[model samples]
Target: MSSGTASSGAGSDDDHAPWPSPLIRDLVDELRRFNRRKTEFYAESVLEASAFAIMLVLSDGRARTLRELTEELGLEQSTVNRQVNNAIKHGYLERFEVAGSLSRFVRPTDTGREAFHHDGMLRAARIEATFADLAPGTPEGLLRELRAFNQAYDRRVLRETGKDVEATGEHRRYG
Candidate 1:
């Protein structure tokens, strides 16, 4: 018997061949994942961008406790606390205490809104435009999906309250 790596096999692009190159869809997905990591890394260095996305998700015109934010972010409380503190320090978030309650609310300040939009949202919109060329579906289809979701969210918000102040607020609260 000849010595060779069993996993590698004789190189062939057949379906049964272990060495067959990854399928086109798999390759595309891989590239997308890689791009996401690279973009996140770049954004992390930008301070405001690192926190903007999380803050925007949190400040969807609703109050979320710090524990809730930590769970949503998949981060430790200390980490969330530090970021929240920085947000407060930077005038991006304000702490709301209900006195003797474990739940404390953190809401975005005006400056936070500006920083979030200028830091991450602006970049994301431009990048999203570029991503239109990456996937199989047309950009129009993706936009339609977004609009549908937005409409659904709006309906829910309106149902909950007579007035809807947008589910995701007008801007991201940089935290």
Candidate 2:
């Protein structure tokens, strides 16, 4: 077994298989740690992480149909519907229909916008404080690398799924 790899204990052939590159394994581990720490930061938040994500997507004050939200978030339609309904129940969002359209659009209410902004600021402050001792420009460099990695990952996913960026409307956001 590789020094850093864990065994399944069953002694199957898979256990002796070559593991992923160290860099990949380390990146995965760090991502898991980051997610756990991020959850802690939102433990006392007014909105759950999923709810905050929905609001973030709509933070520009533009209305989006549930389909659009689902596509943008890469979440199931039912999941998006439930989150949007919950936001509406909390008076953070509203669903309205255009006079001639059957599709309904969801938009953030005044209260929702205020709450989103306040929560976002608090989260940002916590993150900034956590990384305060880092050398200048470190955060910007990290963000740049993260964005590049995400774009590359997204492109790979599209290629493997045989989907085009235009078909998924990802180009609008990622491009």
> Which stretches of candidate 2 lie above 4 Å from their native place?
1-18, 36-44, 135-137, 166-175
Worst 10 residues of 2 by lDDT: 1-10
lDDT of 2 by residue, 1-175 (tens): 2334444355554443354544454556667766675346465577767778888788766788999899877789999999899989999889999888789999988888888888887888886886796666466787778778767877998879877655554544421
Cα deviation in Å at residue 65, candidate 2?
0.7
For residue 113, model 2's alpha carbon misses the true position, in angstroms, by 0.3
Residues 1-175, candidate 1, lDDT per residue (tens digit)? 2122232434555633342444543444554564475235444333454467556665566657778667666579899888888878878888898788878888777777667656665566656887776777766786776567557766777778766334334222223
User: Whose TM-score is greatest here?
Assistant: 2
TM-score for each prediction?
0.55, 0.77
What's model 2's TM-score? Answer: 0.77
- Whole-model lDDT, model 2: 0.74
State how far residue 57 of model 1 sits from its true place (Å).
1.4
For all candidates, the clash counts are 0, 0
Candidate 1 has an lDDT of 0.61
